[model samples]
Target: MKRRRVPALLLDAAAIVAALLDAWVHVDPDDRAAAACALLAAISLTLRRRLPLLTYVLALPAAFVTDAVFATLAALYTLSSLTRRRSLLVVCAAAFVTGDTASWSWPGPEFADLTDSGNLITVTYSLATAAAPVFLGQLVQARRELTVRIAEISKARESERQLLSDSAQAQERARLAREMHDVISHQVSLIAVRAGALQIGNRDPETKEAAATIRRLGVQTLDELRHMVGVLRASGSDPVELTPQPSLTDLPRLVDSSGIEVELHTDLPADLPAAVQRAVYRTVQEALTNVRKHAPGATATIGVHHTGGTLRTTVTNTARTRPALVLPGAHYGLIGLRQRAELLGGTLSAAATPDGGFSLRLELPVQDPG
Candidate 1:
């Protein structure tokens, strides 16, 4: 309301100026008191925003006495938009009736029978004068309220979408952690056990030393990998699925379900270790998720290369082709992937493309010591 004061003041000033001009140009010299009364009515406009009904009550009598239509209109509009008290409306009506009769009292007959043509015209004019501005102001107020409600609805919907996105990401991360724990950790422990047995049984010094080194490296890696996976497992998520987790081979299914146009190329070995395969699948999954969430209708391209001693995975998407619903993100997708890649002795990179889309790249060692 305080912020509204300045604009309201300007509008009231304009109304008062118009009333002053009408009085100065048209009123007779002997009727200068009428002009004075109109100026007084204009001065009362300061209460319009804070005390709109009071402003109206003050304005109507001064308007009747001074012939200041502008002051009356401004007061009526302010009252209609700012308040809706039936008692106040009744008071204003009483004021109007008294003023209307007082104006005609000098030149016309008293209100007797009250059905004469002159009285009828006076009544109709007064009713029209009271109703028009108030009705218009009420219409404007209703439309403004409607607009505010629509904006609130839009903001509320966006917040709900953000919450859903965060929940889904957390669930996916937890699932990944469960898979690494149940599958990769178990396999690595078996390798360590086998190495320990070899070190104990082997007779050759060279063979025994190699087996000892393998056992030590395997144990160290299992410790680090387990720590990272444990952090994910600690998250609140749905119960783990017993079915085998997704891998690189599930890329087609992910793409088909995404509803975004995608092109893919790969030169990966079919027998990639479960950990590497899972990492590659997640990298692609995250990239696609981002595209659908932020760049709807954008085309995507995914590439995998297993060359030399490393496997490199890349997913890139074009800029959004059309307007789409964008939900707020937790911003942890790429950070989590980067940490996972580092744990696997690899690297992850993501950057915006020239077309305003984004690209994610991850490179993992083809083989790890443990």
Candidate 2:
């Protein structure tokens, strides 16, 4: 029901001029009748946008009486703009032609040549006037449809961009979680082993004091682990944040906490990259955790060697005096260890030894020290 004010005004002006021209060109001298028809046609033009069908119906009778070409064209324009039904348009056109013919025949007796070549000219002019409005209306409809299609395309593209961004964010979050698992699991295993040993060993005063110290250290390590997890959880828009992550240099303290006598043999170069060091450290930690869980009372040996551009680590533990405890089958620690090694373009393997023991091996690319 949107009213087109500009088209209405133009139609009104055209109607008025048509009415004046009809009256002036005719042989009959009826100025008052001509002026009345012109005024009525102008008023009818204002209602065209709102009630196009009614305007066309009203215009036929008025045009027949006044022979106002502009009023008929204005009504035709309204029909085209408001309705898309072709049959209705054809019906309206036929009615207009019939009305024009009837109006020409009305002043027949006095002017025999009134419906002659001059009448044909009027018919042609009236059809052209009517058709002009219909063409403009079709052009407007086409423009509107094009605008709608473009808007739909723009919205689809925006949705696709947002989907890609969300997918990338999810991938990054998973990678960070894997790294955190590798770091925390290794640290927690050492604390568990040391705490278990301190509860079972010798009762001399100095020995008791050292055991209590180990127990306290185990408790402190657990607290720090909890704090680290909390910091990771409160990352977004929060003041508390996780400190820089540990890499490989912290491995000595981790190994000491296991309370296992470890013999280290190394030919690894000092210039190894931080990433390679971290992977090697994690592999050793997982191997030692397995030893503490599955091979109690066992002695462990850790060896690091470099040949060509590759650095290798191997951890081996002998059988225990007490029956070996079967560790709970959790893949998170091992899976995380393997992922860390692979991230640095390395490989890792674990195997049972022939003498009721276990061994873990890891190999990584090395940087040579001068």
Candidate 3:
């Protein structure tokens, strides 16, 4: 439950009332000097929050000449809460005890029997009374400081989390850009090579002109792709492996090393495009990775097929038999895979299955080289 704060004006009014009531109970109305001091002390509480030390000093005379001490204690507490000076607080509290323990007489204030049990008890009681407000004020100050520290810590944690998320996203974008360059450049190089061969071997002038045009354009596109790849590569510090990019042939090895029970099935043609094969491989890899991370001890089934001019890849996983362990992740696996598939003119979809399972599917158009 939240605590509501009291208004400073209301609190000050209440303190003045209590101080006036204390004065009425202890001091004789006919005592002009003591009555004036008590009235001044009670009214001084209005400045307690802003001018605590001054307020306490103004209230000290009343505590010495009369029994109206509430205003003095109130001022002491306010000063203690506002300041961090231990020596000053100690002096102020001792002054309050001294004034409160003295007895009022016609001439002036004087100390009673220091050896008597009653006087000793009076000194002890006065000391305890002064200490109470100081202690309470210090406790409130500590609590206010602790609340500020906790707020600072929470803000720092949020900033750290945002930085981590941004770093992860940047790294994932760079990786996808590199992979896209690899697939597009490979296919473009093949086009340039075949067009060059046609230009050299063809007999007709018109056919040679067309082949030369295609080869020239392909080479220009490849050069641009190379420049893009260079920029992507320079942005990261890690050494990149351009060769041995994942393909369908690596799926068997990937499944074996995935550390889970997985069934692999494929009816794909032997001559699928490198981009298509890579998309399938990456989709399956991300799916299997998700299963291992989010569904512990779940069995998965993978299917890849080429039918009716489309290559379809699907990975389905059963409900987990055990609870998944909590692990830290950059959370970019699925997002990167989706962008990879989109770059290759493919579509990827993932969703939870009806039986407390999961499924991810990818579909890419396949054009036969006649």
Most TM-score-accurate candidate: 1
Runs of candidate 3 with Cα error greater than 4 angstroms are 1-6, 106-108, 183-370
For model 2 the local lDDT of residue 127 reads 65
Ranking by TM-score: 1, 3, 2
Candidate with the larger lDDT of 2 and 3: 3
- For model 1, the superposed segments whose C-alpha errors exceed 4 Å read 1-9, 101-114, 234-370
Residues 167-272 of candidate 2 have per-residue lDDT tens digits of 6765665556556557765676577677557656766765665576577666666666666655544434355535344555666766776767678776655667
Spell out the clash pairs found in candidate 3: none
TM-score of 3: 0.53
- Model 1 Cα lDDT, one tens digit per residue, 198-277: 99999999788778767886786698777778667655655554335678888887776566789989876677888888
* Every candidate's lDDT: 0.77, 0.70, 0.87
* Candidate 2: worst-modelled 10 consecutive residues by lDDT: 103-112
lDDT of 3 by residue, 1-370 (tens): 1234456667788999999999999889999999999999999998888899999999989988888888899999999888899899999999988888887776877886879999999999999999999999999899889999999999999999988986886687689677858688889999999999999999999789778877886886787777667656554457565445778999997787676789999987788888788888888888987898899989999999888888889999999999999988999988998898888888889999998999999989897545
How many backbone clashes are present in model 2? 0
In lDDT terms, how accurate is model 2?
0.70
For candidate 2, what is the TM-score?
Answer: 0.48
